[model samples]
Structure formats: structure tokens, C-alpha cells
Target chain A: MAPPEKIELKKQAQQLIEQYDNFLFDCDGVIWLDEKLIPGVLETIEHLESQGKRFAFVTNNSSKSRDTYIEKFHRLGFKGIGKHLIYPTCYAAASYLKEHLKVPAGAKVWVLGDHGIETELKELGYIPVGGSDPRLDDEFHPQHDLLKVDPDVRAVVVGSTKAFNYMRIATTLQYLLHENKSLPFIGTNIDRSYPGPEGLILPAGGSVVNYMSYTSNRDFIDVGKPSKRLLETILEQRDFDKSKTLMIGDTMYTDIKFGNDGQLGGESGGSLLVLSGGTKLKDLHHLIENPASLQDGPSLIPLKYIESFGHIIHLLSN
Target chain B: MAPPEKIELKKQAQQLIEQYDNFLFDCDGVIWLDEKLIPGVLETIEHLESQGKRFAFVTNNSSKSRDTYIEKFHRLGFKGIGKHLIYPTCYAAASYLKEHLKVPAGAKVWVLGDHGIETELKELGYIPVGGSDPRLDDEFHPQHDLLKVDPDVRAVVVGSTKAFNYMRIATTLQYLLHENKSLPFIGTNIDRSYPGPEGLILPAGGSVVNYMSYTSNRDFIDVGKPSKRLLETILEQRDFDKSKTLMIGDTMYTDIKFGNDGQLGGESGGSLLVLSGGTKLKDLHHLIENPASLQDGPSLIPLKYIESFGHIIHLLSN
Candidate 1:
């Protein structure tokens, strides 16, 4: 566990390009912050594309469907990014129901998120309920119809939503606690906060998921980043060798640990930290200083550090 | 060490009354379930009053102020229930700011709960903000003025609220994360759920507090039951001898642990669990069978068990 090597030299950037045949990118801080794209990120990705490096976009934000993300990517100047290349947690949750939990396509999936989850579930042939419902926007009442658990709901998916309220939480609790806590509880992510549009740190999807988990007094199946199942799915779907793949993102706990613990780069280590997003150089230094203070100490430590993934293009131009 | 003694016989009821000079009761389940009074509870309290026993009502609920509780008590058949004799967590939170944290009078306190916390803080010479404000009811927007923290607010108090929404949560998060999280963060209680009307269980104050804690990634000062500070304050305020007091509650984690950990009833052990609210007979059996399963296992186990606090009057009359 040496300190992460800073990718400042052009030689280092070239080595990074040659080190991996595939890349996994985290949205939000990594690719774009809100609606604004980071400088040179598009060029770096285009360079990778020109170099025949395979990649897919992975985001823990379950509020946007893959189709919505496609629009965002295209709007941000990303070209030829197909729906299959985007892996939002909304899609992961829906796919988890179908592939892992064996939930039938037509079964009802209770949602405590936004329209993204509802859209994904609908696209996957499952009926979505309790999400973005106008009724849940009403003030909480003891006898609200939604408070009663629908016997048809096969599982519960909790993610991020701007419409978080007591009605939704209380109703979701019924499903989570229904049948002696029998239903599968799926959480989209575990991110505490994210960089917001106004230079403000806003509560992220994990906070919402954790709130429900706390209220229900039960553990949830996290389908977001750092989850091995998600990593495995992405790797298998893209047909990329784990040893030759790299995870490039701004956050350490999710993206870095995801790459490191998944053995993404094999012995060379697969995770790279970028300062362009939520994490800064000081944050990396702090983690290196107090690695033992966190729960997953070593696994959270990234293999390398750089100013930003976009900095790679700047370095190559020099 | 052993199974809780069941207070069933008339002799047992009489002995219980003789054993304690003061009784601390948990209100939600022990006295009444919502607005409806638990059967025989008033008679039992009257019997204790006739025998010159003193008592105080303690509840984890922070939604209603002490004055509101007075109306509820009078609406039921209870007589002479004074405001000073109530120890709701709202009052505890306000008092903690004043006494423990040494926050100055007239200092602004940020609130993320209902009117109870605001009323209590205002009564204690503090200006309360952010709670029950109509603007917080608006849909969340990144550029909202409330997203900016007020430098004047000295602390943050979070508790239960049926009005919980993203606007309130997002606004409060600014205060909690303000000034490098330097402000004192006070949480009213830690009860996961309470028995609600219509035989339903509802999320409680702890869920809200925990949501903020998780979102902010900071711990809060819990001013509610099972906290030793709350017990000490009650004992000192009421001038009740620890050895002669009994804690009757519907919850094992909060009320029972409050009495047991505070060493109420001296070596005899102070807690008496009532199977009339949330905990059932089966729950107690499970706890007794597996003491090591919970975090605070031994302290949560009650010294005695009863059908209901009101059942004492029925037993004595027999």
C-alpha cells in the first residue's frame, strides 16, 4: 500500500492509455457535473474510442433511466453512445429483479424513487407502483390507500428522488416490513452526498436508501457501484477481461473500491482516482494517511491518482 | 438473568404498588394508544395517586408540545397532569441545548421537525427557524434561498415530522454541514417505530434523526429515552429516589433500558415491560432466548413483565 502514483507526466498518461483495453466511467463528478461537462473529458474519451478502447458509462444515480442518460450524453457531445453502453442503477435494479431474484416480468415492483426507476421497470415488462405517484405527494394520512401493502408487490426498490416525503417513506415501510420482512429490498446506491450545481453538497441516493433501511430495520441489497454483482455484470456484458480493464471515476469508495476489489487491473490494480469530480487531491492524501480509519480500509485505496481523467488529454497534447 | 416476573395476581399487584414511591410511565402504549385511553389505566393511576405515589409521563414522541399533551390528557379522563410532569423529547432537546450544550438564550436554533420542537425552543428563549415554515413545503430547487445556511443559527434539532419532504431535509442538511459541521446536532429520540392507530406500526423520530445523520455523515446528540442524561435530569427534577422509582414502558430498547441502565429500583432492577403497545409476549421470549443477538442485550431486558399497566387495577380489584 504505497501512496497512489500521480498521473501528471505525459508518459504516465500514455502508459495509462496502453495499460487497459477497456474503461468504466462514473457519471456525475467523473463525466459531467450536473448539466455541465468537464473540460477535455469528451476529447479523452474520443481518444480512447479512436484507440479502440472499449468502455461503458456506470452511474449510481437511479433517478435517470438509461434513455434519459443517452439524451444527456448526446447533449454533452458524447457521440455514438448507445443505450446498451449506459448502466444506470435504475436498469441494474430492474435487471436484478429479472436475472437474479427470478421475479416474473409482470410482477409488481414497489418503487420509492423517481420516474427513472418506474420507466426502467416498465421497459423491463414489470409494473411499477408508488413512485412519482401524485398521491404520494399529498400530506401523510394514517388511512392513505398506499399505506396498505399491495399483496402483488414482489420486491421493493429504493433510490434517489427529489419528491422524498413522509407519505412515500411510510408507505414504503409497509412493503419492506410486509409478510414478516419477506420481500427483497433493493437499494440503488450508498453515496452519502454528491457535488451539486450550486457548489453545495447535496444528499445522494444512499442517504434515501439508508433512511428507508433504518426505518424498516432491515438490510437492503445494494445494486450500485462497488457491488461485485454489478461489476461482474458490466464485465461480462462488455466481454472485457478483468485484468485489462480500468475504472476511472471521481469518487473513491464507489468507483475505486469497485475496480480494486473486483481485481479490475489484476496485479497492476484497476482503479484510478480523478480530482475532477467529488474527490480532490487533499482527499486522496487524507485517505492515504488514515486508511485504517474506514471500514474497508485497503480496498478503498485507489491504485493511482490524477488531476482529472480529462487531464489525460491535456497531458497528451503537451 | 432470568425471565421477567409476571404481575398477574392481586397480591403481586399490591406488592408492586408498595415497592415504588414513584412511577415513570411511557405514554404512547402504557397510558393510551393515540387518542383512545388504554382500559383501566386512569383507575390504576388514580389508585397510585390515592396511595400518594408520584409519577411523570415520558414519551419519545416529539411532535406535540407539552401544552398539546395537556389537552390530550384532559380530553381523556386524566386529572391534574401538569406541564412540568411531562418529559417529551422536544422539551428534552430544547433543555439539552440550554443546559448541556450551553447554547445562549435567544440564539437561533435550526429545526427539522414539527411544531413541538419549535414551540419548546421558543418557550426556552431561543428563536427557532426552518420548521413548519411554509416555504419549506415547496418543491426542492437548487437555487432556493433556504439552501443557504444562516450564520446566526447555533444548533440543529431533528425529530419526528409528518411533513418530512426533500425541501425540509435538503435545507436542514445545509445547517448540519455548515461550518465544517461545528454546530451541535441534537436528535430527539431513537425509537424506530411506534404503535399507531388502526393496528399499524408507523415510523418514528429516530428514523428522521438517522436520515439526517446518515446524509450528513455525522453523529447527533440523542436527547431521548435510554440516554443516561435524560434519566439523570428526570431524577434530579422530580426529586425521585433512584432506588424507589419504577419505569413502566411499552418499549424495551428505550424506556426499559432507561430504567435498567440508570439503576432504578436499586438492586431490584427498575424496568417493567407492558405487552400492550409494541412488544408482544413472543418478542420477550425471543430476547430472553438470545441475549447476545442485540447490541445492548442485557440492558434491554426488562426486570418484570405485565399484561398492561391498566391491568394492575383489574388484578387488584380481583
Candidate 2:
């Protein structure tokens, strides 16, 4: 199939900005990749701010904390992004465990991800252990000092990490299986790969957990976007009129598929797909032809094209 | 609080033996602990053999392969226990994934339990990885391998394992959370604890998954005895008359609770609770008075009690 005709997604987004009171923007490929901001992204935000639009950066990446993301945005010239920047990882994990596994507040846990997951678990009264500051010296190594699994450790939560190793993961599995077989093994997300500076790279938390499951013959539960848990968290947080609110994302699998359906965010919510990242233009042709391929149809046809946020600002001003 | 005045569980078993043509026995605390046979268990088996009664060993411990359990039994002095030794772990895992998760048979999986889980996953066409002989200087750490999380890996199947570690568990969580968030995480059992030679140890497979969940902040889909998945597997296995087949176990949680009217197993079958393990005599009084404590309720009761296999044989012979 031919690639989707470029139809100016930014222009359409600009038009929508005029109509809508609030704007939800995705992070990762939409704003920046690694340390560099996407061209025109800052200008788009600046334009939106000047026009009095309420915007929230909604991200599925659960590895880094909001503080980390905010700091990264600041470094990239995003001026006023704050804690309100929403992430689905920690919220998803906490809600999934609480509702499905009935993990009570104050439950003990062995965490292998970042502050996002640890902080969320703590808020739910979960006792988190093993997680360390990634910026600290060699904190990611699963050696003797970091290798021990507490007998009382009730669960193991996996998220994203920069310094993951086979030894550390194996040690955690050994303790979980041999020491506390009754405890749960949970993962915060399941994005198979993530965008890295070099290109798409191994997903930190979800991929590692998947591998451990293969070797150990165990199963893990995921709590991030596209999962019902994450959608529920979004609903709880937004509490907006479902009929009016729209979930806009770039990926077909995580964003569009998880939104709009009662399966995740309830029946009233709507999902809009954008053509900036993940879901390439070629994939849309395949999805359009195959009904089953798109588990749930998108509420609105994805804006076909966008070169940069600058175009969005230009379209809005015009 | 006192133990029920020495009810002759042996006498009741003898009467049942005289009344029925077939007899079923539960493994675990009734017949053995780990590799060691339970006390006086052989004598009862011999007596049952002498009485020419048709019997089979039924178990919910799905961690060990049938051959392994049979071999253990033979080494412990009970010879010729046939391949009909029933295990619920593998069947439960497979059926639940097939029906609920709808995982294709060809999906790759990281299995972290025993041969039973591995063999079953293989039969379902799931790619199984990991495991090595402890004696072979090879380090017996298949779970530590990083390749288990290959992009092709679709699910994590957890069961029971003796060599599970923290690193292995943490890695598995990472993969599930970041790399393959869509991949299913399944657990074969959810028993919080199990009997060990030293008394009660961690219930290996499901128990490990449970603990990891607490730490990891994830949830798991469990498929084992007492779970609805087990009964569904059993019903799918054969078209036996549910009314005629009796479910017997030494534990109230898995065994008795699986009787017809129980939560998961439904109301077409009967259950017999043995007192040799799991539930104590005092617990029965508590259950009888506080019906809510019994998850399956009045439908589950001790149909017959036997001190040991010896008593079962004695009853049959008389």
C-alpha cells in the first residue's frame, strides 16, 4: 500500500486547539527524542501558552519520574511543565495491584524500576525495596550488596532502568520463586521497544520481565497504558466529561486501541490518532483494510500529516 | 480449640472402601513431603494393593512432572504408581491462556517453574526456555540468560522453581513492563505458602509470582486448583460424569473447595477433605461455626477421613 498522503496534522491540531479548552500532548517522539527537543515543539507550546490553552504532557513511558521528565523538558527549553505532567506507569501499577491483586496498602515490595514506580507504590502504602537512584554510582548492579532478597519481601515490581543486568534479574527471580512463591511478580508496562538516541532500543522494564518469564517459566502482570489499569487511572485523574474529552496519541496499539472502549477507559471516551511517531503511515493502510487488525476503531480518522509543531502554530495563527 | 475427640477417620475410610469400587488419593502431605514419603504412607498403599482396590494419586501440585513424582514415589517405597497421577498446573495454565488471554499456540514464552509447566507449554506450542541440571557444573542458572526476552517472546509462564533468584525475577519484570507490555503474564497457582520438610516454606511457583507482584506492583492471572481455570481444564480434558467423579484432597483451600458447589469447581461434584495435612481438626469446628470462613461453604465437607493409607486399606479390606 502507498504511504498515507501527508495532510498537515499540525494544521488540524491547531484548529482543534481553537475549539478545545484543554490539550493533552504525548511525550517521547512527540516532544523530544533523548535530550534534544523536536523542532518547533517549544514554539508550539509557547504559542499554545500565549493563546491560553491548558496543556498536559501525557506519557506512557513509566521509567522516569515526573520530576525527571520535567527536568528533561526544562533542559530542552520547555518553560513551565510541572508535576501535573501525567505518566501512566506508576498510577497504572498502583491501581492494577489494588483492584486486581487486592494488594493492601503497606504491602512489602521489591522494586527494580525508577522513582516513578517506587513513589507510586509508596503512595499506595506498598513497602518498596531494592530500587536505587540510577544516577548514583553503580546502583544498578545486582551484586552481593544489592543481590539479597528480603524474606519478607511480598512482591517484585519491574519498570524501566538504565543499568539492568542478567545477574541482578536472575537474583531477583531466585528470591521470588524460592523464598516467597506466594508473592506476586508485576511489571508496570509492556511496550516492547522504546525510542532511544541511537534508534529503537530494548524496552527497559517490560522487556526484561518478559525475558525473565521465559527463563523462569513464570508470568507477570502489566499495569501501563493500553492496559485497563492505566485507562482507569487516567479516568480517575481527568474526571472530565467523557463525551467531550478526547485521548490523542501517535500509536495505534497503545493509544488509540486503549482509548474509546469500555474495556479500558469506558465506552464514552474517544481516541484520536496522530501521525507523528510509532504508527507509521504505511501501517494505517493495513489497519484500514483489516477490521480485526484494529481491535477497536479510532473515534476520528488520524490526522494524516505533520512536519513540526511550528506548522501547527502557523495554522492556528492564520 | 481442642482437637475433635479422635474421630476414627480410619473407620470412615474403611466404610467408604467397602462402598465404592474406585478410590482416589491426594499427594503432598498425604503421601509425601518433597522427596520423602509421609510417615506410615507405604503401609497404607500396600494394604490398598492387597485389597485389590482401584486407586489413583491426584494432586494439585503442578510444579513437578508426573514422571518426577512417580519416580519420587518409587524411591520412597511405593512402587508402580501409574501415569494416571493427575496434575492440575499445566492444564490450568494452558486452558486459561487459551480461553482468556487467547494467546496463540505458537507464541514464545519464558517458563519459570518445573518440567510440568515446561512440558505443558511446549505441548501448547509455546517456546520454552531455561533449565539445567544442578550437578552439571553449568551453574544451573538458565533464568539468568538475557536472550529469554527476545522480541519473539510473547508471554511469561510462572510455576514452581527451587533455584529462582532476585535477578531472574527483576529481569522478567523489566521485560514484561517495558519491552512486551502486551505479552501475557500468567501464574499457575496462587497458594500463599506450602508444606516443606522443615514445616511450611514458600509455595514455590504461584507463591513466588505473588510475592514479586507485591514488590513489582503488578497483577497476574492465576490458573490452578481452586481457581476457576482448573475446573474448566478438567471439564475440557474429559466428558466424565461430574456427579460420579469425587474430588479429594488433604487441603481445604484447593481440594475441598473444588467440590461441585465450590467457587470455581461448581456444584456437580463432591469433595472429601482429609485431615492428614493442611487443615487441622480444630479448623473444622471453626469452619462449621463460621461458614463465611469456608470460601466454598457447606457444599464442601469431609466426606471421609483416614489417618493414612493404612487406614484406607484397612477400611477397604474390612
Candidate 3:
């Protein structure tokens, strides 16, 4: 209930640096703003890698595939990070369906995102309908017939989409409402606002999923942070000591909540909040000043605070 | 709490007829299903006409203007009705704009319904946009551009639209979300299911309105039945006595609720729920038996009961 202690990254940060061997970084805000990298943050990741620290770029952006994100990593001067270390919400969805949902190959999944999700579904050998096809995706395409719920569509997956329209919403609602709504509804993530170019924030994946859920009067499965599915997928693929892993993010709700929930998977969890983008210190101060103003909001106070991920490199200097 | 008395309309109903002089009828299920007349109902209206009873047609359908509806009325063999006696939700919106919101002439109102709503807006001198325009309405139009919230758009009105798609919704949401959502959002109706030909029910005007409302996170003013705007328009245009007027409708929720709410305007309102369409006796029976299945639903029972309006001729036979 007390205000979280804010610590500068340079002062007495050796203990914080030595405490974590694995660093999970949230992209969009913490690592970069839009397509440009935050100053000194690339150096922070490289310096941490030189110290034998393992790191992964975690993102809820479902428009880009892991390979594309890996290309972005090199383009942004982030060194020693491979495609395998990049955990996007799209890949999280693919891995979740395969390993967790254990959806048999060739089973069809109705998609509601873009090319990123479609590519992931293909890689996992799951037949995907909707999402990318212009005939279905574009509202103006000819043969824009009313949707017939494909009995073959086993699950409905949602992500961020500029193309989400009435047809998509209606078709998806029919599936969820059919037979008293006994189908699996999955989401890439539920981030309310996606950071865009020139500091403009647009409606993200969560808005799409939430709109569908609200209209259908049904719930959904979100595979992105702060969902546990992304964290669980990372732990399943590697063997990192739980206590020595830190989830660093720009958001308290997603990244910090991800770390906290990960502890229930039977290990100590650590989280750090970087204040370079998205939520600012003034927003937290407003909440602190008026705690009872909101009934349900971010309740986690992350362990370490820094002006930006660039500031974290100072911790590695010692 | 007791079950309402189910009076077989034909078995002794002269007193029901004499209590009200103005009989407001809900079309679609009450008079005719689509193009064909609901058997014997035409004779019932004619018989009432001979007895000097007045009537009006109120519909939530926003696609058809009063003129179009009058054409349909004449096409259906109804001799006594005129365009002035018709009250559609589209008219309710126009009236609400002029009389309620007081939107000045030449002000722009963005529409999301069909030609009917646009026609009504034009008649009232409000510059209408979006609904029937090929530039913005057609999904295939060359400039399928992202919507910019036009500052001149004073209100956004929604109704039943087959053309309801992503473009319309996105444009409407931009207006509603602008300036922290300080716009008067109006809906033609909120009828969730529209009974189509061959006994099919499709998502109706309410679904389109609801979808936009859910995404925009803003409440809307429904100018259709269940809402008091339609009734208020009738009162403003006519000199009908409140106590002797009846709202005869097929569905209990909209029609019955309309009559009940009209009482707040200092009038004794009466309603009739026809069993020939929508909610059945069994549904009401289940609700009565359970008592807690829903917190708020159609709790109003009509003053008179009939198998269909066709059976009303039997009431006239006496």
C-alpha cells in the first residue's frame, strides 16, 4: 500500500545486477519507442550479454513474426540475441496451441489477427481460416457473403488488427454463441493501447478481444502478458533458475503482473519497471495520491525503477 | 408475484376494446410478417375503423422512411392509414435531434443506418454524412481511408444496417472517443434479432448499435421502442388522451416497457402484448416459475391477449 521506492540504476545497483542471471525484456516501451531504440538500451543488453547474462525480447505485438522481430533486433544493434530468444505473442499462441492446448495438426483455428498470427499457425501445422484473406478480411471485397460458422474451426484466436470489422466480429460471435458457447477463444494479448509512431497510441489487441467478449457475453484465453501462457512457454523451453530471472517491462500491469503470477508456477519471481514510455511517473503519483479512485487496477509495485532501460547499463558497470 | 391472468382474447373481450380509443400497433409481427398480412388482422383494423377507433404504426426499423412505409402500407391493402400516422425510429431520431438535442440546421450528423435515417435527417435540415454516401459507406470505394473525426459531426446515429461494417464503426468510434467522448450518441433501435423471411432471425439494428457502444465505451440514447422518444414524438404531434390510448405490440420487452415509461410524463399508459410473435407464454411461464433467472426483463403483461391480431376480429364480432 505504501509508495514503491524508486532507485536510480547507477547507485548501489551491483546487488540488483548480480541477483538476476536471466533478463526478460518487454519491447515496445522499455527497449524502444516505436521503431527507434531507447538511448543506451542496446548497449545495456550487449553489456549484460558480455557478463554472461541470458536475455529474451518479449513483445505482445502480434503483427510481426519471430523471424521479423529477430531482424529488428539486429537492426536495432541488440547483439547476441537470436530468433529463438525472441518471444512474441504470436509465437506464444502457436506454442500454446501445440504444447498446452495440444491441438492436433491440421485442426482448423479461426484467426482474427494479421499475417504474424497466420504465419505462426502455419508453422504449427494448424489450418487457419480468416485473418489474412482479402475476400474475408477486406470489407469491400466481392463475394463478401454472410459468415457461415465453419464447423471445422475448433478455436477462435484474436490479436491486434486494423481490419477488425463487423463481419469478423459477427462471424466470431456466432462461434462463441453457438450451442451455448462451447468453444475455445484465444487472444494474442489484451494490451489496451499499442504504442505507435510519433508517440501516438492506438487501440491494441486487448480492445479487439474485449469488444468481442463484451458483445458475445463470453470470456477468452489471452496468451500474451500479463497472461501466464507466455511465461509458461518460456520456462518450458529453457532451464533458468526462477529466482535469478527478472522480468523487466515498461508496464506495471503486464510485465510486473507476469512476474508475480509466474511465482505460482513454483519459483521466486522478480520484476523491474522501466519508465521510458507508456505509463509515466505522474500517473502512478495520481494513483498514489488517490488510491481509492479506482476499484480494480495495477496493484503491483515492481522491485527496481529506472528512467529507462538505458539506465540499467550503469548497474552492470560495477 | 402471481401469474398474470391469461384471457383468451376471443372468449369475452368487449370491455378490452372499449377502454382505449387510440390503438398504437407495432408492425412486423403484430400486423404482417414481411409482405403478407397476418390473416384476419386487416379485417380487425377495418372493423375498428368502422367503430371510430384510431391507430398508428410504430416500428424500430430505420431503413424505411415514412413515405416508403406508407407505400408498403398501401401495398398491403390498409386503406385507412396515412404517412402522418407512422412513427419509425428514424423519425424518432430526427425529432430527437430537432426537439431534444436541438442540433441546428446545416449541422452535420454522421449516420450509421441506411437511407431512411439519412432521408429523415435531410428533411430536418441537418447535413447527413456516412450512411448512404458512396465515398464513406462503400467498403470498395477508392479512398478507404482511416476515419478522421470531423469536428462538424454533432451526433452519430445508428440503426439497422446491412452495410454495418468496420469502416462505419471505426468512423463512429473516432467521433465518440474524441475530446474524451463528449458527443450525443443516438441509436435508432436496439432490437437484437430481426425476424427475416422463411422464419429466420438475423442480428438487427440493436446489434450494430451495441457493437459500436461496446467498442467506444460510451452509452447511447436509443430513440426507438423501449425508449420513450417514439411515444414522446406521438404526443407532440397529436392530441390523444393518455388514459384511453394503448400500445399494442408483439413483444413484451419493447412495447410494454414503452407504455410503462410513458407514465412518467404524467399519463396513464396501457399496453398489449401479442403472443403471435417473439416472446411466448412458455418463456414468461419459465421466468415466473424461476423468479430469478434474470434481474430485468419483460415484466409487463399487456391489458389484452390474443393469439394474433387476426384474432382481434373476434373481439369486434361482439
Question: Residue A5 CA error for candidate 1 (Å)?
Answer: 1.4
- Write model 2 residue lDDT over B1-318, tens digit each, in one string: 222233255566565545444444667767766666766668766765677655556566667666666677788887777655455566567656667788888876766566787777776677765432232223323344452357777677776665454344544555555443566777776554455544433334555565445434457776766665566455445443454455556766666666534332223235556566666666666776776764565544554444544445544445
Chain B of model 3: TM-score?
0.91
lDDT of 1 by residue, A46-77 (tens): 99999999999999999999999999999999
Kindly give the stretch of ten consecutive residues in candidate 1 chain B with the minimal lDDT sum.
Answer: B194-203
Model 2 misplaced regions, further than 4 Å: A1-11, A26-47, A58-62, A74-80, A83-247, A250-271, A274-318, B1-10, B35-40, B60-63, B82-246, B250-270, B275-318
The order by descending DockQ is 1, 3, 2
Residue A288 CA displacement from its true place in model 3, Å: 4.6
- The digit string of per-residue lDDT tens for model 1 on B226-315 reads 999999999999999999999999999999999999999999988999999998998899888898999788999999999899999999
TM-score: which candidate is best? Answer: 1
Query: RMSDs, each prediction?
Result: 1.1, 10.0, 5.1
lDDT of 2 by residue, A1-318 (tens): 233334355466654555554455667667776666776668877877888656566676767766677778888887877775566476567656777788778777777666787877777788877666432223233244544556777677777664454334545555556543566878776555555454433343555555455444467776665666565555567654444444556666666555544232234234555555555566576676774644454422343335444456655556
Worst 10 residues of 2 chain B by lDDT: B131-140
Per-prediction fnat values?
A: 0.76, 0.00, 0.09
Candidate 3 lDDT over B1-318, as tens digits, reads 334545465554565667778878889888887787888888888877888988788998888999889888889898757888999889889889999898899999988889899999999998888887676545532134546667888988988786765566656666777776787999888776644455533456777777677666568998999886678678667667667787878766677667666652134347776777665777556656765555554345444456777776865565
> Backbone collision count in every prediction?
0, 92, 1
Q: Quote the positional error of residue B265 for candidate 2 in Å.
A: 15
